[model samples]
Target: MRQRHKPWADEFLQENTHLIIPDPSNYKNKWHEVFENNNPIHVEIGTGKGQFIAGMAKQFPSINFIGIELAKSVIVSAAEKVQESEHANIRLINENAENLLDMFMTDEISTIYLNFSDPWPKNRHEKRRLTFHSFLKRYENVLKPDGELILKTDNRGLFEYSLVSFSNYGMTLQEVSLDLHALNDPENIMTEYEEKFSAKGQQIYRCKAVFPNQK
Candidate 1:
C-alpha cells in the first residue's frame, strides 16, 4: 500500500489557490482554456518544490501546465511562488499520481513529466516506481492517443528499467537523450532537479514515450 504523506499534508492542499479543478473527478477537460485559445494540457507528477513547473509555465506561456504532487508541505512553497509570480496558465494540486484514473478523463492530458521520480530501487519496491508497467497503464488512461510521457532521472538503473518497460508497453521512444545538460540545444529547459543533479556531476536520462493508439 502507498503510505500516506506526513501529517498536515492537507493544510497546504488548502493553501493551493491557483489549482483549477473544474471537477476533481473529471480532471481531463477545460485545462487548455487558459492559454493559446486552446493549448496542450501537460502534467507533471511529483512536482516537488515546484521549481520545474513554475519555470516551465513561464517559459511556455502558450501551453497549459499542471503540477500534481501529493505532499502538501512541498507543494505549498510552489503554490506561494505561483501566487507571487502571478502565473495564470499554471496550477498546483495535492494528489497522488496513482489515482490518476479517478481524477482525469480519457484523452485529457497531452504530456506528462516524470522528473526525478522516486526510484524505488529495491526488488520488492520496484512496482512502486512511477515508470512501472502498472503505472504506465494508469497513464495511458488519461493521456491522449498521441500524448507523450517525458521522464527525466539521474538513476541509471531506473532509467534503463523504464526504457524496457516502455518498450514492453509498445510505446514509441523519441528525442531520447542520456545527458540533457550536455545538449547545447535551446529546446532543452533545465528543470530545478536537473540543474542540481548536474551540478553534482550526475548524468541525467531523459526520454519521451508516445502512446500512439491508446487514450
Candidate 2:
C-alpha cells in the first residue's frame, strides 16, 4: 500500500530546511566540513521516521549520522523526530539512494545502514532493491577502506537475496543473524518498523558486511 501524501509535508520540510543539507552534492568529499568535525560518518538510506539513526546518534555522540529519504512526505516524519530534541550529530537528507555518488566522494563514509528497505519483491524490480550489487557498488565507492554495511529487515526473501548479493560482490560477511531480536544484542536499537513487526512475533534478519576495497 502506498502512503498517502500529507498536506503539511512541504511546509514541514521547508520550515526545517536547516536540518537538511540542501545541496548535498556540493559537499562531495567535504562531508566532515559540513558537520564541522572529523568524526566518522554513518549513513542510513531510506531512514523512515529516523528512530534508528536518532537512537544511534544519542548512543554514539562522537559519530556523525546522516539519514536519507527521497519522499518529502515520508521524510517529514523523520524531520519531526529530530526537531523534538537536540541532536547536533544528526542531519537528514531528502535524496534518492541512486544519486548518492553525486553527494559523496570515494571513501567518504565509514558505515552504511539499510534497515527494512523496500523489498521491491518482483524479479524484474531486483535492481531497485537497496541490497542489489549495483547499489552495493555505489556504497562501496563511498565507504572508506574496510567500511561496513549493516542491514536489518523482516522480509525473509529480501534477506536471503541480500545474503547472496553481498557474497557475490565478495564482501566479507560477519554478524549474520536470521533472528535479530533473539540475539539479544544489548546495543540493538529498534527502528519504527522493527518495533511493530517484533510485536507481531516476526523474526528480524540482520548482517554486517565489509567492503574489501584493496582485495
Candidate 3:
C-alpha cells in the first residue's frame, strides 16, 4: 500500500524532536541515559500510529519503549500519540530497522516486538521481510543474550517463515500461538492493525523466541 503523504509531517517532527528522537545513532549504547533510568529497553519495529508502543508503555511503566518507523508521515502520527499520553518511558525513532546496529549497542535491548509487519510475501522480496535472516542478524547483534523477540501478525505466511528463520538461527521458541486472540490474553496489547483484523474474525499468530546463550 502506498503511504499517504502528510503535508505537516516535517513541521510536526521539527517541533517534537524530544518525542521522536533525531540523530538517534549518537545515543548508541547510552539509551538508558535518554530515559534517565536503567530499565530494560524494548523496541517495536514498524510501530504504526504508536498504538502498541504507547499501550505497552502505559502497561509497563518500568521498561523503556522505543518505536522505530521509517515513514515520516506515519511516525508523525505516532509521535502525536506519545506526546498526548505524556508517557516518559516511551520514545519514537524515525528510522529504518535496517540501521538497528547504528542506534543500539550489544545487549542494549531486552525485547523486540514485530507487530503486524508487512509480509512482503513475494519470493523476490523475501529479504525485505522483517523476519529475513539479515534483519535477524541485526536483532541478534543488539539484543541481550536472553532477549526475547516477540512477533504478532495476522499473516500466516510471514509467521511460518519467521518460525523457520528463528529455528535456523538457533533461537529457541518459548511460546507459539496459532490463534492468539482465542486465548483471550489480557496481557496482549493489540496494535491498530491487530484490532482491525481481529474484528474481522481473523486469527492472530504470535510467537516468543529467544536467542541461544551466547557462549
Candidate 4:
C-alpha cells in the first residue's frame, strides 16, 4: 500500500551505485571512510522510497547518512536518490533491521533514525518490533557512547511501547512529543511517511533517547 513515486525518483538512482555497500562484513567498522574526512554516520531505518533520506542528505551537509531498508524495490529506489544527488555523504544498504548489530561494530554509529517504522500491532508480535528491548540493546552496541536514537511514528501503541522499552534499557529519554507538528523544530524534517501520516490527521509521536557514555 506504499506509494512508489517521489516526483524525482528516476534522476536520483542514476549515480548512487557506489553508496550501496555490498559486503557489510568487510567494512563493518569503517563505514565513515566512505565519506570525506570520516564524518559521523547517521542511519535511517525503513527508508521507504527515498525522498526522506535524499532530502536529508541535501539539508544536513555535515553528517553522513545511510538509509537501510529491507525491501529490494524500495532500497533500489532509495539508492537511486543518493545516486541522483551524487553526494558522497549519503549511502544505502538493503538489509533488515535485525541484522543491524551484526553489520556494524560497537561505537561505530553516531545516530539512528526510525521514521514511521512498522508498528507490529499484535501483542504477541511486539518483540519483533524495532523498539523492543532486545533491539535497543543491539542498537546500544553499535551506537557511540552518548549516541542518540530518534524515532517517529503515527501509531500510538508503538510509541507507547517504545517509551517503555527505551526507559527499561537505561537510556535517557527526552524531547518526547505526541504531536510532532506542534513543535515546529527544524531538526524534525518531514519524510514521505511523515507527510502521509500528517495528512491523515494521525498524531505523530517523536522522541530522542541517548546511550550512556563509556567510562
Q: All candidates' TM-scores?
A: 0.87, 0.96, 0.98, 0.89
Give lDDT for model 1: 0.79
- Tens-place lDDT per residue, model 4, 8-82, is 533444444477676666778877666646778888888887887888888888888888887666777667566
Q: What is the C-alpha lDDT profile of model 2 across 1-215, one tens digit per residue?
A: 47678998877777776787787898888878878999999999999988898899899999999999998887888887877758899889999999999988988899999999999999999999999989999999999998999999999999999999999999999889989988889889999999999999999999999977672
Query: Clash totals for all models, in order?
Result: 0, 0, 0, 5
- Candidate closer to the true structure by lDDT (higher is better), 2 or 3: 3
Q: How well is each residue in 93-183 modelled by candidate 1, as lDDT tens digits?
A: 6778887887777888889999999998899998899999999998898988988899999989999999999999888998788887777
Tens-place lDDT per residue, model 3, 84-146, is 888999989999899999999999999999999999989999999999989999999899999
Query: Which candidate number maximizes TM-score?
Result: 3
Q: What lDDT is reached at residue 107 by model 2?
A: 88
lDDT of 1 at 124: 100
TM-score of 4: 0.89
Superior by lDDT: candidate 2 or candidate 4: 2
Would you list the clashing residue pairs of candidate 2?
none
Candidate 3: clashing pairs of residues: none
In candidate 4, stretches whose alpha carbon ends up further than 4 angstroms from where it belongs are 2-17
TM-score-based ranking: 3, 2, 4, 1
